[model samples]
Target: MKFYCSIHEIKKTKTVLVGVPYDGTSTYRPGSRFAPQAIREASYGIESYSPYQDKDLRDIRFYDIGDIPLSYGDKELNLKLIEAFIIKLIMKGKKTLALGGEHLITYPLIKAYAKKYKEFAIVQLDAHSDLIDSYRGESLSHATVMRRCSEIVGFENLYQLGIRSMVEEDKLLPHRDVNMGLFDLSKAEEFLKRIGDKPIYLTVDLDVLDPSIFPGTGTPEPGGITYKEILSFLKLLRQKKIIGADVVELSPHYDPTGVSSVVAASIVREILLIMGN
Candidate 1:
Protein backbone atom coordinates (compact mmCIF):
# COMPACT_ATOMS: atom_id res chain seq x y z
CA MET A 1 0.00 0.00 0.00
CA LYS A 2 1.05 3.60 -0.44
CA PHE A 3 2.24 5.66 2.51
CA TYR A 4 -0.58 7.35 4.43
CA CYS A 5 -2.13 10.24 2.48
CA SER A 6 0.18 9.90 -0.52
CA ILE A 7 -1.37 11.14 -3.76
CA HIS A 8 -1.49 9.15 -7.02
CA GLU A 9 0.11 11.74 -9.29
CA ILE A 10 3.82 12.58 -9.13
CA LYS A 11 3.57 15.48 -11.59
CA LYS A 12 1.55 17.58 -9.14
CA THR A 13 3.94 17.46 -6.18
CA LYS A 14 7.32 18.88 -5.29
CA THR A 15 8.00 15.93 -2.92
CA VAL A 16 8.33 12.39 -4.28
CA LEU A 17 8.69 9.32 -2.07
CA VAL A 18 10.26 6.09 -3.36
CA GLY A 19 11.37 2.87 -1.74
CA VAL A 20 14.73 1.19 -2.35
CA PRO A 21 14.52 -2.45 -1.28
CA TYR A 22 18.07 -3.66 -1.80
CA ASP A 23 19.99 -5.05 1.20
CA GLY A 24 22.85 -6.94 -0.44
CA THR A 25 25.39 -5.38 1.91
CA SER A 26 23.76 -5.93 5.29
CA THR A 27 26.36 -7.69 7.42
CA TYR A 28 24.56 -8.64 10.62
CA ARG A 29 20.77 -8.71 10.05
CA PRO A 30 19.35 -8.88 6.53
CA GLY A 31 15.63 -8.18 6.75
CA SER A 32 15.74 -4.43 6.04
CA ARG A 33 14.76 -5.27 2.48
CA PHE A 34 11.32 -5.87 3.96
CA ALA A 35 11.17 -2.50 5.70
CA PRO A 36 9.72 -0.33 2.93
CA GLN A 37 6.48 -2.30 2.87
CA ALA A 38 6.45 -2.75 6.61
CA ILE A 39 6.61 0.98 7.16
CA ARG A 40 3.86 1.52 4.57
CA GLU A 41 1.66 -0.97 6.40
CA ALA A 42 2.42 0.70 9.68
CA SER A 43 1.55 4.12 8.34
CA TYR A 44 -2.10 3.15 8.64
CA GLY A 45 -1.76 3.08 12.41
CA ILE A 46 -1.05 6.77 12.70
CA GLU A 47 -2.91 9.88 11.60
CA SER A 48 -1.65 12.08 8.78
CA TYR A 49 -1.75 15.07 11.12
CA SER A 50 1.42 15.69 13.12
CA PRO A 51 0.71 17.43 16.41
CA TYR A 52 4.40 18.13 16.98
CA GLN A 53 4.77 20.21 13.80
CA ASP A 54 1.22 21.48 13.82
CA LYS A 55 1.01 20.26 10.23
CA ASP A 56 -1.08 17.70 8.36
CA LEU A 57 -0.08 15.45 5.46
CA ARG A 58 -3.30 16.36 3.66
CA ASP A 59 -2.06 19.92 3.47
CA ILE A 60 0.84 18.86 1.19
CA ARG A 61 1.16 17.05 -2.14
CA PHE A 62 3.41 13.98 -2.31
CA TYR A 63 3.36 10.78 -4.35
CA ASP A 64 4.60 7.37 -3.32
CA ILE A 65 6.05 5.60 -6.39
CA GLY A 66 6.49 2.33 -4.47
CA ASP A 67 9.75 0.41 -4.33
CA ILE A 68 12.37 0.50 -7.04
CA PRO A 69 12.84 -2.79 -8.89
CA LEU A 70 16.25 -4.16 -7.94
CA SER A 71 17.98 -7.43 -8.68
CA TYR A 72 19.66 -9.47 -5.97
CA GLY A 73 23.46 -10.13 -5.70
CA ASP A 74 24.50 -7.43 -8.18
CA LYS A 75 25.50 -4.55 -5.92
CA GLU A 76 27.22 -2.40 -8.54
CA LEU A 77 24.35 -2.56 -11.02
CA ASN A 78 21.78 -1.78 -8.33
CA LEU A 79 23.76 1.20 -7.15
CA LYS A 80 24.00 2.49 -10.70
CA LEU A 81 20.29 2.01 -11.19
CA ILE A 82 19.51 3.91 -7.98
CA GLU A 83 21.77 6.76 -9.02
CA ALA A 84 20.20 6.93 -12.46
CA PHE A 85 16.66 6.83 -11.07
CA ILE A 86 17.39 9.55 -8.53
CA ILE A 87 18.98 11.68 -11.24
CA LYS A 88 15.74 11.48 -13.20
CA LEU A 89 13.76 12.65 -10.16
CA ILE A 90 16.17 15.49 -9.48
CA MET A 91 16.06 16.57 -13.10
CA LYS A 92 12.31 16.88 -12.69
CA GLY A 93 12.82 19.26 -9.71
CA LYS A 94 11.40 16.86 -7.14
CA LYS A 95 12.54 16.67 -3.54
CA THR A 96 12.98 12.95 -2.88
CA LEU A 97 12.37 11.01 0.35
CA ALA A 98 13.60 7.43 0.03
CA LEU A 99 12.58 4.49 2.22
CA GLY A 100 15.77 2.52 2.23
CA GLY A 101 16.53 -1.21 2.14
CA GLU A 102 19.91 -0.39 3.65
CA HIS A 103 22.08 2.60 4.46
CA LEU A 104 24.21 1.77 1.40
CA ILE A 105 21.41 3.26 -0.69
CA THR A 106 22.40 6.68 0.63
CA TYR A 107 25.67 6.50 -1.32
CA PRO A 108 23.88 6.42 -4.66
CA LEU A 109 21.29 8.96 -3.57
CA ILE A 110 24.04 11.40 -2.61
CA LYS A 111 25.88 10.59 -5.81
CA ALA A 112 22.82 11.62 -7.76
CA TYR A 113 22.52 14.77 -5.67
CA ALA A 114 26.17 15.61 -6.29
CA LYS A 115 25.54 15.61 -10.02
CA LYS A 116 22.90 18.32 -9.71
CA TYR A 117 24.10 20.51 -6.85
CA LYS A 118 27.60 21.91 -6.55
CA GLU A 119 27.44 22.28 -2.75
CA PHE A 120 25.41 20.43 -0.12
CA ALA A 121 25.76 18.82 3.31
CA ILE A 122 24.70 15.43 4.65
CA VAL A 123 23.03 15.23 8.06
CA GLN A 124 23.30 11.67 9.43
CA LEU A 125 21.31 10.53 12.45
CA ASP A 126 22.24 7.00 13.44
CA ALA A 127 23.60 4.76 16.16
CA HIS A 128 26.72 3.83 14.24
CA SER A 129 29.08 6.18 12.45
CA ASP A 130 29.13 4.03 9.26
CA LEU A 131 32.51 5.55 8.40
CA ILE A 132 34.58 2.42 7.97
CA ASP A 133 36.61 2.16 4.80
CA SER A 134 35.52 -1.46 4.20
CA TYR A 135 33.63 -4.32 5.83
CA ARG A 136 34.49 -8.03 5.44
CA GLY A 137 36.51 -7.37 2.27
CA GLU A 138 33.72 -5.35 0.66
CA SER A 139 34.24 -1.61 0.30
CA LEU A 140 30.68 -0.72 -0.62
CA SER A 141 28.74 -2.36 2.22
CA HIS A 142 26.47 -0.51 4.66
CA ALA A 143 29.35 -0.17 7.15
CA THR A 144 31.21 2.05 4.72
CA VAL A 145 28.32 4.06 3.31
CA MET A 146 29.14 7.28 5.15
CA ARG A 147 32.84 6.88 4.44
CA ARG A 148 32.05 6.61 0.74
CA CYS A 149 29.70 9.57 0.96
CA SER A 150 32.35 11.59 2.77
CA GLU A 151 34.56 11.14 -0.27
CA ILE A 152 32.00 12.67 -2.63
CA VAL A 153 30.99 15.57 -0.39
CA GLY A 154 34.22 15.87 1.60
CA PHE A 155 34.50 15.02 5.31
CA GLU A 156 33.92 18.59 6.36
CA ASN A 157 30.50 18.58 4.72
CA LEU A 158 29.14 15.59 6.68
CA TYR A 159 27.48 16.15 10.07
CA GLN A 160 27.04 12.96 12.09
CA LEU A 161 24.72 13.02 15.14
CA GLY A 162 23.72 10.53 17.84
CA ILE A 163 26.67 8.26 17.04
CA ARG A 164 27.19 5.89 19.97
CA SER A 165 29.02 3.08 18.15
CA MET A 166 32.18 3.18 16.05
CA VAL A 167 35.52 1.41 15.77
CA GLU A 168 38.94 2.82 16.56
CA GLU A 169 39.65 3.33 12.87
CA ASP A 170 36.42 5.26 12.39
CA LYS A 171 37.54 7.67 15.11
CA LEU A 172 40.58 8.64 13.03
CA LEU A 173 38.50 9.79 10.08
CA PRO A 174 38.08 13.55 9.76
CA HIS A 175 34.41 14.38 10.22
CA ARG A 176 33.01 17.89 10.26
CA ASP A 177 31.15 17.30 13.51
CA VAL A 178 29.98 14.24 15.44
CA ASN A 179 27.81 14.05 18.57
CA MET A 180 28.88 10.75 20.08
CA GLY A 181 26.41 10.05 22.89
CA LEU A 182 23.15 11.81 22.04
CA PHE A 183 21.73 14.62 19.96
CA ASP A 184 23.09 17.90 21.20
CA LEU A 185 21.39 21.07 20.05
CA SER A 186 24.47 23.16 20.79
CA LYS A 187 26.70 21.14 18.46
CA ALA A 188 23.96 20.93 15.87
CA GLU A 189 23.64 24.69 15.93
CA GLU A 190 27.38 25.02 15.26
CA PHE A 191 27.13 22.87 12.14
CA LEU A 192 23.99 24.63 10.99
CA LYS A 193 25.63 28.01 11.27
CA ARG A 194 28.70 26.79 9.41
CA ILE A 195 26.72 25.39 6.51
CA GLY A 196 24.69 28.59 6.31
CA ASP A 197 22.20 28.20 3.48
CA LYS A 198 23.60 25.04 1.89
CA PRO A 199 21.05 22.43 0.93
CA ILE A 200 20.85 19.37 3.22
CA TYR A 201 20.29 15.69 2.53
CA LEU A 202 19.15 13.97 5.74
CA THR A 203 19.65 10.24 6.45
CA VAL A 204 18.05 8.73 9.55
CA ASP A 205 18.84 5.20 10.70
CA LEU A 206 16.08 4.10 13.14
CA ASP A 207 18.61 2.41 15.40
CA VAL A 208 19.47 5.85 16.66
CA LEU A 209 16.49 5.55 18.96
CA ASP A 210 16.90 3.42 22.08
CA PRO A 211 16.38 -0.32 21.56
CA SER A 212 13.71 -0.31 24.24
CA ILE A 213 11.65 2.03 22.07
CA PHE A 214 12.80 0.87 18.58
CA PRO A 215 14.21 -2.63 18.46
CA GLY A 216 13.49 -3.55 14.85
CA THR A 217 16.83 -2.59 13.48
CA GLY A 218 19.71 -4.79 12.31
CA THR A 219 22.37 -3.28 14.55
CA PRO A 220 20.67 -2.18 17.74
CA GLU A 221 22.85 0.04 19.84
CA PRO A 222 22.03 1.00 23.39
CA GLY A 223 22.01 4.46 25.04
CA GLY A 224 20.12 6.04 22.16
CA ILE A 225 17.98 9.15 22.30
CA THR A 226 14.27 9.10 23.07
CA TYR A 227 11.46 9.66 20.54
CA LYS A 228 10.76 13.09 21.99
CA GLU A 229 14.39 14.05 21.51
CA ILE A 230 14.26 13.01 17.86
CA LEU A 231 11.13 15.05 17.28
CA SER A 232 12.83 18.03 18.83
CA PHE A 233 15.78 17.56 16.49
CA LEU A 234 13.56 17.35 13.41
CA LYS A 235 11.75 20.45 14.55
CA LEU A 236 15.08 22.23 14.41
CA LEU A 237 15.37 21.38 10.71
CA ARG A 238 12.00 22.79 9.70
CA GLN A 239 13.55 26.14 8.85
CA LYS A 240 16.54 24.69 6.99
CA LYS A 241 16.54 23.85 3.33
CA ILE A 242 16.14 20.06 3.30
CA ILE A 243 16.64 19.06 -0.31
CA GLY A 244 16.15 15.34 0.17
CA ALA A 245 16.08 12.63 2.84
CA ASP A 246 15.89 8.86 3.61
CA VAL A 247 15.00 6.69 6.63
CA VAL A 248 16.96 3.45 6.71
CA GLU A 249 17.74 0.30 8.74
CA LEU A 250 14.30 -0.65 10.05
CA SER A 251 14.15 -4.47 10.43
CA PRO A 252 10.54 -4.98 11.56
CA HIS A 253 10.80 -8.69 12.37
CA TYR A 254 13.00 -7.90 15.33
CA ASP A 255 10.11 -6.18 16.99
CA PRO A 256 6.86 -8.19 16.76
CA THR A 257 4.89 -5.47 18.58
CA GLY A 258 4.99 -3.41 15.33
CA VAL A 259 5.90 -0.26 17.25
CA SER A 260 9.15 0.20 15.32
CA SER A 261 7.43 0.41 11.96
CA VAL A 262 4.96 2.90 13.35
CA VAL A 263 7.86 4.93 14.63
CA ALA A 264 9.43 4.86 11.19
CA ALA A 265 6.17 5.85 9.57
CA SER A 266 5.70 8.72 12.01
CA ILE A 267 9.17 10.02 11.23
CA VAL A 268 8.34 9.79 7.55
CA ARG A 269 5.26 11.91 8.13
CA GLU A 270 7.24 14.57 9.97
CA ILE A 271 9.83 14.59 7.19
CA LEU A 272 7.13 14.98 4.53
CA LEU A 273 5.74 17.95 6.42
CA ILE A 274 9.19 19.45 6.70
CA MET A 275 9.75 19.10 2.97
CA GLY A 276 6.32 20.47 2.20
CA ASN A 277 6.88 23.49 4.40
Candidate 2:
Protein backbone atom coordinates (compact mmCIF):
# COMPACT_ATOMS: atom_id res chain seq x y z
CA MET A 1 0.00 0.00 0.00
CA LYS A 2 2.88 2.38 -0.54
CA PHE A 3 1.77 4.59 -3.46
CA TYR A 4 -1.57 4.04 -5.15
CA CYS A 5 -2.70 7.64 -4.66
CA SER A 6 -0.24 9.62 -6.74
CA ILE A 7 -0.50 13.40 -7.04
CA HIS A 8 1.00 14.89 -10.16
CA GLU A 9 0.50 18.38 -11.58
CA ILE A 10 -1.03 17.74 -14.99
CA LYS A 11 -3.57 20.30 -16.26
CA LYS A 12 -6.34 17.94 -17.45
CA THR A 13 -6.36 15.34 -14.65
CA LYS A 14 -9.73 14.74 -13.03
CA THR A 15 -9.10 11.82 -10.66
CA VAL A 16 -7.64 11.40 -7.16
CA LEU A 17 -6.37 7.95 -6.20
CA VAL A 18 -5.06 6.23 -3.06
CA GLY A 19 -3.38 3.02 -1.92
CA VAL A 20 -4.74 1.16 1.10
CA PRO A 21 -1.98 -1.34 1.89
CA TYR A 22 -3.23 -3.09 4.96
CA ASP A 23 -3.58 -6.87 4.64
CA GLY A 24 -3.70 -7.89 8.26
CA THR A 25 -5.91 -10.97 8.22
CA SER A 26 -5.01 -12.82 5.06
CA THR A 27 -4.95 -16.55 5.81
CA TYR A 28 -2.73 -17.79 3.00
CA ARG A 29 0.43 -16.30 1.49
CA PRO A 30 1.13 -13.24 3.66
CA GLY A 31 2.66 -10.65 1.34
CA SER A 32 -0.06 -9.23 -0.90
CA ARG A 33 -0.41 -6.36 1.53
CA PHE A 34 2.82 -5.02 0.06
CA ALA A 35 1.55 -4.87 -3.53
CA PRO A 36 0.82 -1.13 -3.67
CA GLN A 37 4.52 -0.24 -3.43
CA ALA A 38 5.49 -2.55 -6.28
CA ILE A 39 2.70 -1.21 -8.49
CA ARG A 40 3.82 2.41 -7.95
CA GLU A 41 7.43 1.55 -8.67
CA ALA A 42 6.33 -0.15 -11.88
CA SER A 43 4.35 2.95 -12.90
CA TYR A 44 7.65 4.75 -13.52
CA GLY A 45 8.23 2.25 -16.33
CA ILE A 46 5.01 3.04 -18.28
CA GLU A 47 4.93 5.33 -21.30
CA SER A 48 2.96 8.48 -20.45
CA TYR A 49 1.12 8.12 -23.80
CA SER A 50 -2.23 6.42 -24.16
CA PRO A 51 -3.40 4.52 -27.22
CA TYR A 52 -7.10 4.51 -26.23
CA GLN A 53 -7.55 7.52 -23.98
CA ASP A 54 -6.59 10.74 -25.70
CA LYS A 55 -3.05 11.92 -24.92
CA ASP A 56 -4.72 14.41 -22.58
CA LEU A 57 -5.14 11.60 -20.04
CA ARG A 58 -1.41 11.64 -19.46
CA ASP A 59 -1.75 15.40 -18.98
CA ILE A 60 -4.27 15.00 -16.16
CA ARG A 61 -3.34 16.18 -12.65
CA PHE A 62 -3.72 13.57 -9.92
CA TYR A 63 -2.68 12.98 -6.30
CA ASP A 64 -0.75 10.07 -4.84
CA ILE A 65 -1.75 10.08 -1.14
CA GLY A 66 0.55 7.14 -0.53
CA ASP A 67 -0.59 4.62 2.05
CA ILE A 68 -3.30 5.51 4.46
CA PRO A 69 -2.68 5.12 8.21
CA LEU A 70 -3.50 1.44 8.69
CA SER A 71 -4.37 -0.13 12.01
CA TYR A 72 -2.57 -3.40 11.53
CA GLY A 73 -2.65 -4.28 15.19
CA ASP A 74 -6.21 -3.18 15.77
CA LYS A 75 -8.80 -4.48 13.32
CA GLU A 76 -11.52 -2.14 14.52
CA LEU A 77 -9.35 0.91 14.00
CA ASN A 78 -8.41 -0.28 10.51
CA LEU A 79 -12.06 -0.20 9.54
CA LYS A 80 -12.50 3.27 10.96
CA LEU A 81 -9.46 4.69 9.15
CA ILE A 82 -10.46 3.27 5.75
CA GLU A 83 -14.08 4.30 6.07
CA ALA A 84 -13.15 7.86 6.96
CA PHE A 85 -10.46 8.29 4.33
CA ILE A 86 -12.70 7.05 1.50
CA ILE A 87 -15.56 9.32 2.55
CA LYS A 88 -13.17 12.28 2.73
CA LEU A 89 -11.95 11.69 -0.82
CA ILE A 90 -15.41 11.38 -2.40
CA MET A 91 -16.68 14.42 -0.51
CA LYS A 92 -13.96 16.46 -2.26
CA GLY A 93 -15.57 15.64 -5.64
CA LYS A 94 -12.52 13.65 -6.67
CA LYS A 95 -13.07 10.15 -8.09
CA THR A 96 -10.96 7.55 -6.28
CA LEU A 97 -9.33 4.47 -7.79
CA ALA A 98 -7.70 2.47 -5.01
CA LEU A 99 -4.66 0.19 -5.17
CA GLY A 100 -5.39 -2.52 -2.68
CA GLY A 101 -3.47 -4.29 0.06
CA GLU A 102 -5.91 -7.17 -0.09
CA HIS A 103 -9.46 -7.87 -1.15
CA LEU A 104 -10.74 -7.45 2.43
CA ILE A 105 -10.19 -3.69 2.26
CA THR A 106 -13.05 -3.38 -0.23
CA TYR A 107 -15.78 -3.82 2.39
CA PRO A 108 -14.94 -0.83 4.56
CA LEU A 109 -14.18 1.15 1.42
CA ILE A 110 -17.69 0.59 0.05
CA LYS A 111 -19.16 1.72 3.35
CA ALA A 112 -17.70 5.16 2.64
CA TYR A 113 -18.58 5.21 -1.07
CA ALA A 114 -22.16 4.17 -0.36
CA LYS A 115 -22.74 7.23 1.78
CA LYS A 116 -23.05 9.44 -1.29
CA TYR A 117 -23.62 6.91 -4.06
CA LYS A 118 -26.11 4.41 -2.75
CA GLU A 119 -26.60 2.63 -6.05
CA PHE A 120 -22.92 1.77 -6.33
CA ALA A 121 -22.18 -1.70 -7.80
CA ILE A 122 -19.11 -3.94 -8.02
CA VAL A 123 -17.74 -5.86 -10.99
CA GLN A 124 -15.38 -8.20 -9.17
CA LEU A 125 -12.83 -10.27 -11.05
CA ASP A 126 -11.55 -13.09 -8.89
CA ALA A 127 -11.16 -16.88 -8.67
CA HIS A 128 -12.74 -17.47 -5.29
CA SER A 129 -16.31 -16.36 -4.69
CA ASP A 130 -15.17 -14.73 -1.39
CA LEU A 131 -18.56 -15.34 0.21
CA ILE A 132 -17.32 -16.92 3.42
CA ASP A 133 -18.73 -15.96 6.82
CA SER A 134 -15.30 -15.91 8.40
CA TYR A 135 -11.79 -17.27 7.96
CA ARG A 136 -10.26 -18.85 11.06
CA GLY A 137 -13.01 -17.06 12.97
CA GLU A 138 -11.93 -13.68 11.65
CA SER A 139 -15.04 -12.25 10.15
CA LEU A 140 -13.32 -9.30 8.54
CA SER A 141 -10.54 -11.27 6.88
CA HIS A 142 -10.06 -11.10 3.13
CA ALA A 143 -11.83 -14.43 2.66
CA THR A 144 -15.09 -12.90 3.80
CA VAL A 145 -14.88 -9.57 1.99
CA MET A 146 -17.78 -10.21 -0.38
CA ARG A 147 -19.89 -11.27 2.56
CA ARG A 148 -19.10 -8.03 4.32
CA CYS A 149 -19.61 -6.01 1.14
CA SER A 150 -23.04 -7.52 0.77
CA GLU A 151 -23.85 -6.59 4.34
CA ILE A 152 -22.65 -2.99 4.20
CA VAL A 153 -23.33 -2.02 0.59
CA GLY A 154 -26.41 -4.19 -0.03
CA PHE A 155 -26.39 -7.14 -2.46
CA GLU A 156 -28.86 -5.87 -5.03
CA ASN A 157 -26.21 -4.10 -7.12
CA LEU A 158 -23.24 -6.50 -6.97
CA TYR A 159 -22.13 -8.68 -9.89
CA GLN A 160 -19.30 -11.18 -9.47
CA LEU A 161 -17.16 -12.48 -12.33
CA GLY A 162 -14.39 -15.11 -12.72
CA ILE A 163 -15.46 -16.98 -9.58
CA ARG A 164 -14.44 -20.67 -9.70
CA SER A 165 -13.22 -21.63 -6.25
CA MET A 166 -15.83 -22.33 -3.62
CA VAL A 167 -15.77 -22.81 0.17
CA GLU A 168 -18.42 -24.79 2.06
CA GLU A 169 -19.20 -21.69 4.07
CA ASP A 170 -20.00 -19.80 0.89
CA LYS A 171 -22.81 -22.18 -0.03
CA LEU A 172 -24.59 -21.28 3.20
CA LEU A 173 -23.93 -17.55 2.90
CA PRO A 174 -27.32 -17.04 1.20
CA HIS A 175 -25.97 -15.32 -1.94
CA ARG A 176 -28.59 -16.73 -4.28
CA ASP A 177 -29.64 -13.25 -5.32
CA VAL A 178 -26.11 -11.85 -5.90
CA ASN A 179 -26.52 -12.34 -9.74
CA MET A 180 -23.21 -14.25 -9.90
CA GLY A 181 -21.97 -16.38 -12.82
CA LEU A 182 -19.24 -18.68 -11.45
CA PHE A 183 -17.00 -20.70 -13.79
CA ASP A 184 -13.44 -21.72 -14.61
CA LEU A 185 -11.63 -19.88 -17.41
CA SER A 186 -12.11 -22.83 -19.78
CA LYS A 187 -15.76 -21.85 -19.77
CA ALA A 188 -15.25 -18.07 -19.52
CA GLU A 189 -16.34 -17.49 -23.11
CA GLU A 190 -19.52 -19.52 -22.70
CA PHE A 191 -20.17 -17.93 -19.30
CA LEU A 192 -20.14 -14.42 -20.72
CA LYS A 193 -22.33 -15.61 -23.57
CA ARG A 194 -25.26 -15.99 -21.19
CA ILE A 195 -24.74 -12.67 -19.32
CA GLY A 196 -24.63 -10.13 -22.13
CA ASP A 197 -24.55 -6.70 -20.35
CA LYS A 198 -24.56 -4.41 -17.24
CA PRO A 199 -22.91 -1.47 -15.35
CA ILE A 200 -19.70 -2.46 -13.61
CA TYR A 201 -17.11 -1.36 -11.05
CA LEU A 202 -14.09 -3.61 -11.62
CA THR A 203 -12.26 -5.07 -8.61
CA VAL A 204 -9.51 -7.43 -9.67
CA ASP A 205 -7.32 -9.60 -7.50
CA LEU A 206 -4.34 -10.86 -9.52
CA ASP A 207 -5.10 -14.35 -8.28
CA VAL A 208 -8.01 -14.30 -10.67
CA LEU A 209 -5.50 -14.79 -13.44
CA ASP A 210 -3.74 -18.11 -13.94
CA PRO A 211 -0.65 -18.52 -11.76
CA SER A 212 1.52 -18.79 -14.83
CA ILE A 213 0.68 -15.17 -15.60
CA PHE A 214 0.63 -13.92 -11.99
CA PRO A 215 1.84 -16.25 -9.25
CA GLY A 216 2.27 -13.48 -6.72
CA THR A 217 -1.04 -13.26 -4.98
CA GLY A 218 -1.96 -14.26 -1.40
CA THR A 219 -3.97 -17.18 -2.72
CA PRO A 220 -3.30 -18.82 -6.09
CA GLU A 221 -5.93 -21.35 -6.92
CA PRO A 222 -5.79 -23.55 -10.03
CA GLY A 223 -8.10 -23.20 -13.06
CA GLY A 224 -8.24 -19.41 -12.89
CA ILE A 225 -9.19 -17.21 -15.87
CA THR A 226 -6.86 -16.41 -18.74
CA TYR A 227 -5.51 -12.90 -19.46
CA LYS A 228 -7.01 -12.83 -22.95
CA GLU A 229 -10.43 -13.91 -21.72
CA ILE A 230 -10.42 -11.40 -18.88
CA LEU A 231 -9.78 -8.54 -21.26
CA SER A 232 -12.32 -9.95 -23.68
CA PHE A 233 -15.02 -9.88 -21.02
CA LEU A 234 -14.07 -6.29 -20.25
CA LYS A 235 -14.32 -5.56 -23.96
CA LEU A 236 -17.81 -7.03 -24.07
CA LEU A 237 -19.05 -4.47 -21.56
CA ARG A 238 -21.27 -2.32 -23.74
CA GLN A 239 -23.28 0.79 -22.88
CA LYS A 240 -22.45 0.35 -19.19
CA LYS A 241 -21.38 3.11 -16.83
CA ILE A 242 -18.28 2.36 -14.77
CA ILE A 243 -18.13 4.66 -11.78
CA GLY A 244 -14.98 3.51 -9.93
CA ALA A 245 -12.70 0.46 -9.85
CA ASP A 246 -9.76 -1.24 -8.13
CA VAL A 247 -6.96 -3.80 -8.72
CA VAL A 248 -5.84 -5.53 -5.58
CA GLU A 249 -3.78 -8.51 -4.25
CA LEU A 250 -0.52 -8.75 -6.15
CA SER A 251 2.49 -9.90 -4.11
CA PRO A 252 5.54 -8.95 -6.15
CA HIS A 253 7.96 -11.29 -4.43
CA TYR A 254 6.56 -14.33 -6.20
CA ASP A 255 6.38 -12.75 -9.63
CA PRO A 256 9.49 -14.25 -11.23
CA THR A 257 9.50 -11.79 -14.12
CA GLY A 258 7.78 -8.80 -12.51
CA VAL A 259 4.73 -9.59 -14.62
CA SER A 260 2.01 -9.25 -11.98
CA SER A 261 2.42 -5.56 -11.23
CA VAL A 262 2.84 -4.82 -14.91
CA VAL A 263 -0.44 -6.60 -15.51
CA ALA A 264 -2.08 -4.56 -12.77
CA ALA A 265 -0.65 -1.32 -14.18
CA SER A 266 -1.78 -2.23 -17.66
CA ILE A 267 -5.27 -3.00 -16.42
CA VAL A 268 -5.43 0.51 -15.00
CA ARG A 269 -4.38 1.82 -18.39
CA GLU A 270 -7.14 -0.15 -20.09
CA ILE A 271 -9.69 1.29 -17.68
CA LEU A 272 -8.57 4.76 -18.73
CA LEU A 273 -8.99 3.74 -22.35
CA ILE A 274 -12.44 2.16 -21.91
CA MET A 275 -13.64 5.11 -19.86
CA GLY A 276 -12.30 7.53 -22.45
CA ASN A 277 -13.25 11.04 -23.56
After superposition, the stretches of candidate 1 with alpha carbons farther than 4 Å from their true spots are 1-8, 176-186
Alpha-carbon local distance difference test for all models: 0.88, 0.69
TM-score: which candidate is best?
1
TM-score of candidate 1 relative to the true fold? 0.95
Candidate 2 lDDT score relative to the true structure: 0.69
Candidate 1: the clashing residue pairs are: none
| lDDT, candidate 2, 1-277, per-residue tens | 1222333442234455678887787777777768878887877777656543345344445556677878767878988998898888777765667788888888877787778775656667888888877778888888888888888656655567668787755655554434566764444344344334543466777788888887888889877777777766665543456556667888888786888888777666555545443
Per-prediction TM-score to the true structure, in the order listed: 0.95, 0.84
Native-vs-model 1 lDDT?
0.88
lDDT tens digits, residues 1-277, model 1?
Answer: 2363435566789898899998898988889999999999998888988899998898888888888899888999999999999999988999999998899999999999999999899998988888888788989989999999999998888888888788877766775335233443336676777778999999999888999999999999888888988898899898899999999999999999999999999999999999998
